[model samples]
Target: MTDPQVEPAPTRALPLVIAPPRGRQKPPRHLADLSAEERAAAAAELGEPAFRVKQVAHHYFGRLERDPANMTDLPAKNRDAIASALLPKLLDPVRTMEADQGTTRKTLWRLFDGALVESVLMRYPERATICVSSQAGCAMACPFCATGQGGLQRNMSTAEIIDQVVDGASAMANGLVPGGPGRLSNVVFMGMGEPMANYKAVIGAIRRMVAPAPDGLGMSARNITLSTVGLVPRIKQLTDEGIPVTLAVSLHAPDDELRDELVPINTHFKVAETVEAAWEYAKKSKRRVSIEYAMMRDINDQAWRADLLGDVLNAYGDWNWVHVNLIPLNPTDSGPMLNGQVFTRSRSDDMREFVRRLEAKGISTTIRDTRGDEINAACGQLAATE
Candidate 1:
């Protein structure tokens, strides 16, 4: 007898390309890509003093100023040369769209090589958050994702990634977004790509984000969240890296058979190994790992699956080391459809029941607030289409 509550898994199969294409044009070098010492050396190579590098760093990191014309502290003769050398223009704003009564702003940027990526700044009453992309498009090829549908163009350089946050910070500092000029308090690696695949650049960007001002953005490491589709090796590497940023595992389904279809990476790293790796990360980092589950109607949103998920997470001795963030499926019109069936968001009653089942197992759970759906700026919808 078939279980009426569970829908049959999609018949479609997606090709898994673990490696990004080779020989793509590299992003231009900017100061954000280098360490403080490296930046000083580069400045000296340009015939400028080390303090000139510090002045430019202060303007870029402390005052949120990027324009050389506004950096009056530098001598007029050397200003443009230093700025041109260290702070090459990385992200050119192509178009920006606003939502949520002008509180949510999404900017589409054109990289120097013409690769398009997106960043979103969302303002709440107390704090603002920016979701930045780590790569131009994605190679993960998860069938339900819009960016995955487009495939990967290239991994963004560290400076390219940091520039998005800098742009958002500048906007907030200048009173561009609503809520009267607030500071950007949080950043999430959830915009357009699977961050773990672009590990080097992503970690570099994170280092720049948490370092003290005049050297980097000086944001708290705790305020940054990096999401991955259960990249086990990368998760273990992050555990040993000593930086304590929160880790989010996008485990859409609890069982191997279902998760293999939902998150294609599961075929290589099964559910048990993935969840255990996440648990180890939590134990080491002392930061709770987030389990991100996108609720799709009749696909992975069954109450029984929620119970299974809670059990899987609790197997590591349930020391409150994990939290389940149930995400409402933000459907994309351009996403791949299987057998003429478009993936849809779970119903309200089903979502409520899913929450109840997880909480019953002593697992903390919350439904993520869906935002910017009207303008296609929500989760899983950022493709940066021209």
Candidate 2:
């Protein structure tokens, strides 16, 4: 009798191509997003125990990348297969750049596909935060940000996005980061792309973030913030997701004229309309909406514009529903090589006084301490260097 031959089981391969029209073809669904039952079904497909799905999740979530071998929990063969299905190829750190007294570290990761996306790990005395990228490159052409300047290459798979967090969490848990073994308490989708544009996967990553370990990563929703440059309808959509993450709107200007230029999307959805939608989201989410104002010199940085900003926000019915994050313009590579940002032209302190005008009117305000400027890691600055 001739020896019988067996074929190798199929594995997942992400199609690397220019993403087709978003509606024409569905983006490749990742196994990370599936429910427990679905994960069991996937485990069963690999000729492994359905229960091993939970064990694999424990490897990723409960232990925070504690080696499956270290689990001492699952049978050898099953642990290997389970780890392969979920983590697959992990992101190895290619470069680590730090600034702000080692409190902020921006890691450039090479995915299995070799696509370069950056994530930032920032430390505050009370909390450690991770800023994650939702897409590889951004399509939003915000002239000030390097990532936006690169243009959109592709959206990250859910696993690809979530893994950045898992990797960061693991790094923190293992004392690999500056402060040893501190918990990662905050997640921000403000690093690379317009997160709301990659709606589905971002939502999936959020669900995975808050779910209890073994079933999910178990991070709190309050510690996570999903930022967007005023994508009106999507802001409306997030209200239904029922997660109470604070929403940060990148409203770079108070009026349509400058905003139309600074934030191009303003041309499509006017400032008034955007804030109204933000208001709806605030009411539904029952959380304060964050308005991100990028201060540029002699460009939307006028005292009149400040007063107008306060008035416009006041028109939203109550100033208490909104707060503004004033990001002083970080220098970009376009100006000079080493000292890239042209801060000589603008003083952010002047803008701080403008924010004071809003605070004078009974509105809440916070001047975000600038971090990671030395590494070209500030918001929108990543794609610039890439």
Task: List the global CA lDDT of all models.
Answer: 0.83, 0.72
lDDT of 2 at 21: 32
| Per-candidate TM-score against the hidden true structure | 0.94, 0.87
| Model 2 stretches astray by more than 4 angstroms | 1-31, 333-345, 379-386
Clashing pairs in 2: 145-380, 146-380, 146-383, 146-384, 147-383, 331-341
How accurate locally is residue 10 in candidate 2, as Cα lDDT from 0 to 100? 12
Q: Please, what are the lDDT tens digits per residue for candidate 1 over residues 1-386?
A: 00000112223454677677899778777988887679878987988888888888889989888899999988998889889988999999888888888988888888998888888888888788898889887777776666776677888999999999999999998899977777999999988788999999999999999999888999999999999998899999999999999999988899999887677888899999999999999999999999888888788889889989988998996489999998887754434454465577789999999999999999999988777776778533433346
Question: Which residue pairs collide, candidate 1?
Answer: none
Cα lDDT tens digits, model 2, 1-386, are: 00000001112122222232353333333456677778878877878777677777777787876465676677776666666665576466778887777777788876665567888888778888898988877676665555665577678877778888987888778777776788888998887778988898899999999999877789999889899988888999998889999898988788898787666788789999999998888888889988877666666678888888888888876537998877666644334121232322247677777778878877777666676656767543443445
lDDT, candidate 1, equals: 0.83
